[model samples]
Every structure is written in structure tokens, then in C-alpha cells.
Target: MTNTPTHNRERSCIACGAKASKADLLRIVRTAEGISFDASGKLAGRGAYVCSPECFDKARTGRLSHALKTKVSNEEAQVVAQALQAHIQRA
Candidate 1:
């Protein structure tokens, strides 16, 4: 019998720099369309991770823009934050 090793993808939080499983952290994606929360974790774009809402807030200040390699406007950040808040409430 052949044995195979399972792989778990890990990502770092853009805000606090914490390492965690990709699924455990929230993903924010920036594409041509714009930036938004990627709940599916399979969005086709530059993605950054945040481990918690507090971290997410910190990310909006500047870290997210650096990670995405694009300028994140206040409006876009607000929209994404709203989506994250809704998703958290849902969960």
C-alpha cells in the first residue's frame, strides 16, 4: 500500500502577521473589478488574509494595500468591511 501525506495550506494575516490555515482566516481579494471579501477562498485575484475583525481593521489602514499591490480606497475598504461584518454575523 502507498501512503500519501495530506497538505494543509497556510497563510499569514496581513494585519497581525499570524500564520494560520487558509480556511481559518478570512480572505480579501483584489481583482480588476475591485476589492472585496472572498468568503469562498477561491477568488481569482490578489488575496490577503486577516485572522480576526480587529486585524481586518488594522489591515484597512495600510497593510492590505501593501499586500494587494494596489491602492485601497476608503469606500472600497468600507464595502469589504460591511461584507465581513455581515458574514461574521451570519456565522
Candidate 2:
């Protein structure tokens, strides 16, 4: 995967419906395998981008599933939510 620069990558915010460069957002991808962060930003799979950890809750609620065209269970969403929460707390 390519850790491509976020420049020029127009990613829409899942919560607010705002558009911005991918560099300004975090991406979560739902591939054939499972769910994971698109850290490299060049993974080949279905993707949904959010503005930040704050938006994670909303994304996991239904926005993410809607965007990815899949089901995101509450438990699965909580995992990501807590993980992100911890990361944000660390920051």
C-alpha cells in the first residue's frame, strides 16, 4: 500500500457532509477481509473517511455502514470507538 500524501484527495466528512483533503481526515476501510484504518491511504477497497476521532461515534452509528454498504455492529463500532478514544486521550 502507498502511504500517499493526503494532498488533493477529496474526502468527504461522514458526519458533517463537508469536503476536505484526505490529509485532513482519517479513513476507515471495510474490505473483503474486514475493517481497518487506511493508514497507507492507498489501499484497494471500499473506504469511508471521517474528520477525526470526535466524529468516530457518528460514523460508527450508521454513517460508516451506509457509506461502506455494509453492517457495522455495535460491538465492532465500540471497539473502534474506544480505540480511537484512547488514541485521542494519549494525544
Strongest candidate by lDDT:
1
lDDT of 1 by residue, 38-89 (tens): 9999999999999887788998979999999999999999999998999888
- Model 2, global lDDT: 0.77
lDDT over C-alpha atoms for residue 90 of model 1: 92
The residue-by-residue lDDT of candidate 2 on 1-91, one tens digit each, is: 9576666668788988778887667777887876766666678889888877778776787789998888988877777677666655665
TM-score of each: 0.90, 0.75
- True lDDT of residue 35, candidate 1: 97
Query: Where in model 2 is the C-alpha error above 4 Å?
Result: 1-7, 86-91
Q: Would you give me the overall lDDT of model 1?
A: 0.91
> What clash pairs does model 1 have?
none
Top candidate by TM-score: 1
